[model samples]
Target: MASGTEIPAETVAGRKGALSTVISIDAMGGDRGPAAVVAGLVLSAAELPDARFILHGDQAVLSPLLARAPTLAGRVDLRHAERVVTMEDKPSQVMRHGQGTSMFSTIDAVKNGEAPVAVSCGNTGALMAVAMLRLRKLPGVNRPAIACYWPSRNPSGLNVMLDVGADIKAEAADLLQFAAMGTSYARNSLGLARPRVGLLNVGTEEHKGRAELHQAYAQMSAAASAGEFDFVGFVEGSDIPSDRVDVIVTDGFTGNVALKTGEGTAKLISGFLREALGSTLLARLGALLAMGALKRLQARADPRRANGGVFLGLNGTVIKSHGSADATGIAAAVRLAHQLARADLANRIAARVASTGLAGQDAAATGAEAGTAE
Candidate 1:
């Protein structure tokens, strides 16, 4: 039996009855531990007036934390798990012996229909492994991808990019599926009716990029109509944050590198701006005059505002929050998860893939064979 006090059956009945949208959370997964997770829940509760949470972690550790957070008294359902998956734990080991861990318990809640979404700041690999094992992949999804929001110049102020570290490699068909999934995400999350998707390449020219990208380009182009998205052929790295495309599709290797590089560049630029502003009295005076604009810029460019990465192609929606996320970052992730859940994100992606026929078994098999041959 789980040790923590379970929210009453009547209180936790349906997603819409007592709670708005319940999100299962791995309280023990983050670097800041359960305290930060509980704090995040308090923050999220204020932001999402209708949101509820199922927090899974060690009872002894979490009980005290919850007692300290009186605001979350009836809003959270606590599930006790004795073990935790450390950052050092390998995905393979977790998959083999993950039954009693908090991460597994968190995913299992979504798997069992207790919640529509699962959020974790745990080991990405282990979390993905447990999710795939418990929730399994959505039908017609060959290789699941991790899609994240990128601060962009678009009207919506964000662009969706996928495979941001779920798997290092993506075949042509996989990339095609990523496009469909990303388009679904953009449509649902950003309220875009027909999202423009661009395959990531060295250049925008159709002739550029390797064989797989070319193949993906052709496949996405053909399926654009059925997928209800506009395929913009190829998009270069510079176009990622541009308003030209709503979704950027690429393999995990390139996407992860780009994601990290962009984050590092943002930090570097912010540091440079701070140093330059403080270097001279004149610059400091100028900064003080533009303080409001600078604050707006800071808020607009804050990575914490776009923290969660949605694990696409899963049977249940799973959000991977950054492991080092603090209370604000965790709350941001939880908010994103709740937004996606309210939008019925999982069903939208599945329906898009199924209707497009891009996820057919033959296409996946062919792409897998081609990837191996390469």
Candidate 2:
């Protein structure tokens, strides 16, 4: 398919209804290949009967997969692409040579308004590079942040955090923008009317951590009312899984490390539990008694339930699923992308950025002004 070519809605057979939501998928991006991607679509189709997909990948490989899955027969429109962006590909390299790649084409569909959202399990850097190149950033957004749902004790069972490896460094003004964007996401996605926001720090004390965080704290406090979120001051890393804050804002470096560490820790705990449960025949009998409760706990802590990392501050919604996501994980990501797209998350972030007034001023100047104003 040509870049930016518009595939008419009539071409998709199962999407004649007016309420159907269209999603573009990078079929060749996941580690497990097109089969996993197609399987995910099938799972999503079973749950979301009104969802339609525009799959971009090699026709030869995807044709047989789609044929086997009768559920997606009329709900999908295939857009063939010859290239694939590997995990090793750098963002700059992909930018220059990724014309017809699946990742690029998937994002292009969203840019052309053929789909409201695009989901890719491709290289994070390459996906973001292509998305920014094609869809561009929303007005007044100096930098785009990647926000993800973290399972927590909130009523919604999740909290929003941003800049999880989208960029390593952020100024005080950027942090404030992340807060605004995160607040909008939490409100729209999690159904929070007034989300509480926090700045991640080494210590919860006002005087702890770097100068930029202090500046960000002051700015967030000043803009919380206008941004429609409550500023909860500084929160330590331990507060991420706590219900005290609904949104946590941090630079990409810290946020990415924390995210990986949390994932690792969850896996470690799961492994320990499995070993302990099967340690003896008596323990196995006890495990059978507790199987129902264990299942509930597993479901609650499942990483697959929170699969997509939303690219905030973009013109269109782009969800970056984990590269190694299985069918279940991909389905979770698809559901998230659909919800955000249906809610018009891009416009919400844009409006929040405009209201917070973080985008208009220079980063350094905004910090100085915020300090003076406080």
Q: List residue ranges in candidate 2 displaced over 4 A.
A: 1-17, 356-374
Candidate 1 residue-wise lDDT, 1-374, digit = tens: 12112222322356547545789999997899989888999999998887889999999999999999899988888999999999999999999999999999999999888888999999999998999999889988999999999999998889999989999999999998898888777766676767899999998877888999988888888998767688888998999999999999999999999999999999999999999999999999999999999999988988888999999899889999999899999999998887677656676567667764543222122222211121
Clashing residue pairs in all predictions, respectively, total 0, 0
- TM-score on alpha carbons, each prediction: 0.90, 0.91
Candidate 1 to truth, TM: 0.90
Candidate 1 segments exceeding 4 Å error: 1-19, 356-374
TM accuracy, model 2: 0.91
Report how far residue 83 has shifted in candidate 2, in Å: 0.9
